[model samples]
Target: MTTAGEAVTASESVTEGESYDFVVVGAGACGLVAALAAREAGKSALVLEKLDEPGGNTTLSTGSVPGAGTRFQREAGIDDSPARMVEDLLRTSGPHEAEELVSWMAESSAEVIEWLVDEHAVGLYLITDYKHVGHSVPRLHAPADRNGANLTADLVRACDRAGVTIRTRTPVAGLLVEADRVAGVTVDPVDGVRHDIRAEAVLLASNGFAASRALLERWIPVMAHTPYHGGAGSTGESIVWAEQLGAALANETAYQAYAAVATEAGDILSWTTVELGAVIVGPDGHRLGDESVGYSAFAEVIASVASESFTIMDQRIYDYVSRNEPRFVKIIDLGCVPEAPDVTALAALIGCDGQTLAGTLAAAAASAAAGTADEFGRTDLAGNGLQAPYYVCRTHPALFHTQGGVAVDQHARVVSTSGTPITGLYAGGGVAAGISGRDGAAGYASGNGLSTAVGLGYAAGRHVGR
Candidate 1:
């Protein structure tokens, strides 16, 4: 009685011959959000993850995302707006190829967060403790643990509820091109067989090439020696595939770097240590440049100066930051951070002269208390100064993720080299040009990476559905 087309529609699976509305490559936060947006709008979507797990670098992050002018911010009595958010981002990142995206993301940030929480049942509460690395206000929203894995899990659950099929360990070998248009992709399964998935729209939300040494050397050569702390699923395959389709790449050299990853422990020391008046010391056990440049930019300074380093902090600052961040509290319990009662003991602990350590801490505390510039020109010292009972941790810089990929419009459509939209092709997250200024780690702002990932994915999913 029913035709073959009706049977395929009834199946709700993306079969080889039948076409879906949206086919999202990658099942990380970006791809999951994109699929959710599309499916929520009554569009058929299929999410393919090359890895067995869905979470990528997103899982590795703290999962903090910013929203401007949200109801939560208003309730918290904080004043903000799209314009203010744009100004903050530009002031940190400088001008770049995707300057317009800064405004676009800022404008839609609140809506994106709201949608994720209200519509998808994702648990995201506004963080009022302190403004992180590159923000001027307390606009960050995160889960209870401040882990992105929670966010990714919520999105996956949302996608499942929306009847979207998410297949893991299914790698997209290449795009199925019909002439100049990208129709779908050829996915390779474990059986060594290729399956064609035809879709009306394709989204490249796979990730950046931080895992690929060749691509890192090609674009971000300066960061070649840095530790790679990105998602294993990222090999620049998605970006390269898109570029081959005439997609224009922009801001390819920009990346998010962290200066405080424990060198031996293989854990992030949390930037809170530095933000709370801690200082980075080189091999000589002397303070380095400004710690206020943020973990992203200061990472470049660390890489250029020394491989072995130490973060010195006081008990009061450590307790305050650890109280707010559960991850740091765990780090404290791990005994990774050694404590010293005073400058002399601290010098003995780090193998340095007591006079030199005493002088450095004294000068820094004096500067913070007097509200004057130290030798490093750092301001905004939390808790005013470091007190007795200090803590020290050996740390190093790491490359988190590349901030460049396929260029897209505000709507997240992959644009060709001529600045025209590539038919049926969309991109977001690390697979798209980021809002950070072109090149180097200096331009990275707080939550800039996740803002682009979730913001652009939200846009692409909604726009593509229409």
Candidate 2:
């Protein structure tokens, strides 16, 4: 392990005898935010990250977080509120074990964004480009470039400015408890030397078990075979440790999956391509299913048809998506998106019958023209119609992350199976039970992950500081 000179927050490596008022596990968006909040509340805070770098899965995401009522939304002339966000989330996620968390986070989301921006100087703007998965209004906020890495960097900088020490390459072996209350965490570094660091309160923001095949098979068997595309540190050790302490688990089977990851390049193709009138087709050049089912739920559609599929879009849709998603520009630069001039050329690309491909496009065009729902019950065709000179990328479905863990109270404190809050033990982000639904991918709304991550982190730190 390196010294403070090599760390992101310019903090020294945690020594055995070091103690803080707040100790946070995982240096992702949640942990950093919690540490910053703790500092703001006049508390000593230290963050421990397993990875050498701070950001975890947050770096790979779009960095979008939902805020129901914020100044940015008000300035954009968008009407929204926490209640509206709760309704939208419930409509998409249906019934869930963490339904209370949905409302709690929704109420705290706007404050989280404002705190990150107004207080910490994290650059965030309201996104008005397109409607997100569950929200009715444009309440989702993101970085200017819409990159999660930028968000992570901003938070890291905020932590540094707040004098929050972050120790990298510090993996927590287990929780240190006294009298059934969490006291601190035992650090297990690569050199195998163990250090017991004490803290008045411990926050588990270490994310979920998306990278753990055994955990996936045990908790979410249906998605056991799905490809994982999250951080390596998400191996469910936090859940295991918490469960050993009799912490209650909720929404254990819920997760988020994406439908269109570029197969060879392993880059996310952005569902905006489909949302803007692109279609995914099977090997036979036949439409797979409704493309507008939203990305997470659409993964099941793609998986049911084939191991891999082709996302078909035209120049208009491609250019529109490229204007917003910078990652798509890189995908195009890598020659991942192949161009086909017409139906025959596209057929040659897919090795399918030209007539079959032509028939499929004709049907979609007919549906768009008539303003009627297609056979798949998709009616919201956004781009009007597809033009010649098509771009098709081979895509596959993958699991982005699991959205389940130990249950937490409204204050973000870990609770017992008997419904009592575990003293000194708080959880947020993927380490806490997600606000998404209890079972499947269909319940995940856009920004649901960050909503819980940042929201609960803010709440946990404030409560601990108090």
Top of the candidates by lDDT = 2
TM-score of each: 0.94, 0.95
* Model 1 per-residue lDDT tens digits across residues 220-279: 999887888778988888898888778999999999999988765787888877876789
**Per-prediction count of colliding residue pairs?**
0, 0
**How high a TM-score does candidate 1 get?**
0.94
lDDT of each structure? 0.85, 0.87
Error of 2 at 232 (Å): 0.7
Candidate 1 ranges beyond 4 A from true positions = 1-15
**What does each candidate score in C-alpha RMSD?**
4.8, 4.5
lDDT of 2 by residue, 1-466 (tens): 1111112111232556778999999999889999999899999999999888999999999899999899999998888999999999999988989899999998888888998999999988898978877778998899887889999999999999999999999888777777667778778777556667788999999999999889999999888888888889888888888887788999989999998899878889888788778998888999888877788888866776688888999999999888888989989989989999998999898888999999998899888888999889989775456889999998899999999899999889999999999888999999999977998898889998988889999999899878
Cα error, residue 43 of model 1, in Å, equals: 1.1
Q: Against the true structure, candidate 1 has what lDDT? A: 0.85
lDDT of 1 at 315: 81
